[model samples]
Target: MDDLNLGKKLQMYRTSRSMSIRELSDATGITASMLSQIEHEQVNPSINSLNNIAKALGVPLYCFFQEEIIKEPVVRHDSRKTIGRPENAEEVYYELLTPDTNGTIEFCMMVIPPHSNSFDSVHCHTGEEVAYFLGDGDHIGITIEGRTLHLKRDDSVRIAPFSNHVWHNDTDQTARVIFAITPPSF
Candidate 1:
């Protein structure tokens, strides 16, 4: 994410809703002091924290990083917007393949590190998603609802809305995957 503008956008969104930092903290389960730091750009927030904040604010997570709507048809790889939390143990990187989140579908590439998982707990979003595993060699594990599924190169899985799921890379090699989601939840 753009650290320079993240704080400004967050502050604008929070104040526009007439909600205080404490109120946002209560709604997002984040500490008020930490939220203040995030608003002031003193520290970077984890992906989970940002997701919670976005959900609580009723806004998409990409809004903080997206500067403007793209009028062009093509999005260059170098110009893609990215957001990640390096502080987390499972440091996954995501790059937007689409210009912005305003489109009907959100497309992005995820890079999962070796022996890493996407989140600390089960994750669920309002939008339905399809994740396609890319590259060769190692297989990735995805647990949706209560079933575990292994995906190899070229394998894909469709995730229903609000289904608890997590992505795992158990192999020593890094795994790459692409995700397409409707309604652009993340």
Candidate 2:
């Protein structure tokens, strides 16, 4: 079952890059016919062949075994995957709004309950992040590098990479925010 799925994914990635089977075959040193068979799920490729293909496609070998491929660009609200809350923070929730692909940017929706914080401590990551407030009521509190900024509705803020940051919702209403991170450090 996994072999067939891998073949389909390979085909999708190759076609998405506008690369022909012959081109991939020449780049990977595999025969064109074998490449076609592998793409069609008619035959399974060895580990070495898969590694070569992955190199030619400019993707990691593990990409074939990751989550299901996104058939469309839009992510439905109910179908979004949750990244799970912090161990010490139950008042916050996170949902991944973008598909996990070979992209540098990742979108996530975060909900912070009233009068609560997202995490117990500030966290830092390698990639930059920008967060925008969604609702028209209340201001979301964001602390970055010891500076606190209160963001109003539709307001956005950028945070540098490696800066310690956390979010808080001090109002009586829930705070909703959509954040985009580059290089997907989360």
Candidate 3:
């Protein structure tokens, strides 16, 4: 996300509500300077900070991310209609907004087109997981609790379910990585 661009969106929302930085600060208990930084996109906000602002602005926290999606009454982004995509293209399929589930955690879908590489070369997180999936030969490779649980299409496995686990599909076909991340890995 463009940090600088965020300021404009924040400013728009604030002004539309006829709320100044000081007013927002009083309402949200946030410093006006911090609010100004956020409005200018100079600072990336923490979850608590975002929630405070969302409350003050009378919007959902997810409104800041899915600008276009929030405009629709229903979630309309479809995966099947994604054009020019290969048989197993690596693409983010969906973004789930669950306020009841602490809202900080996010779940996104990734389709790894056959014989393709991950957009995240390698990454790390902080929790655990109970993992399972299926695909083609050597299709699923997940690092779970220090063990590399590998599975092929239709094969299933269980993991401890932690954020430290990593998933990779190094095959000629696409594999889906179903995830549950804490503290929201958006």
Per-model TM-score on C-alpha atoms:
0.86, 0.60, 0.42
Residue-level lDDT of model 1, residues 1-186, one tens digit each, is 653377788899999999999999999999999999988888778777888898888887877766464668698877766777645546887878987777778999988889888877888888999999995447999999979999989999999999999998889887889999997877
Model 2 steric clash pairs: none
Residue-pair clash count for candidate 2: 0
Question: What's the candidate order when arranged by decreasing TM-score?
Answer: 1, 2, 3
Ordered by lDDT, highest first, the candidates read 1, 2, 3
List residue ranges in candidate 3 displaced over 4 A. Answer: 1-102, 119-121, 127-138, 144-146, 153-165
- lDDT comparing candidate 2 with the true structure: 0.75
Which regions of candidate 2 deviate over 4 angstroms? Answer: 1-68, 85-90
For model 2, give the RMSD to the true fold: 12.7
Tens digit per residue, CA lDDT, model 3, 69-99: 2333343445222211233234423234232
Q: lDDT of all predictions, in order shown?
A: 0.83, 0.75, 0.54
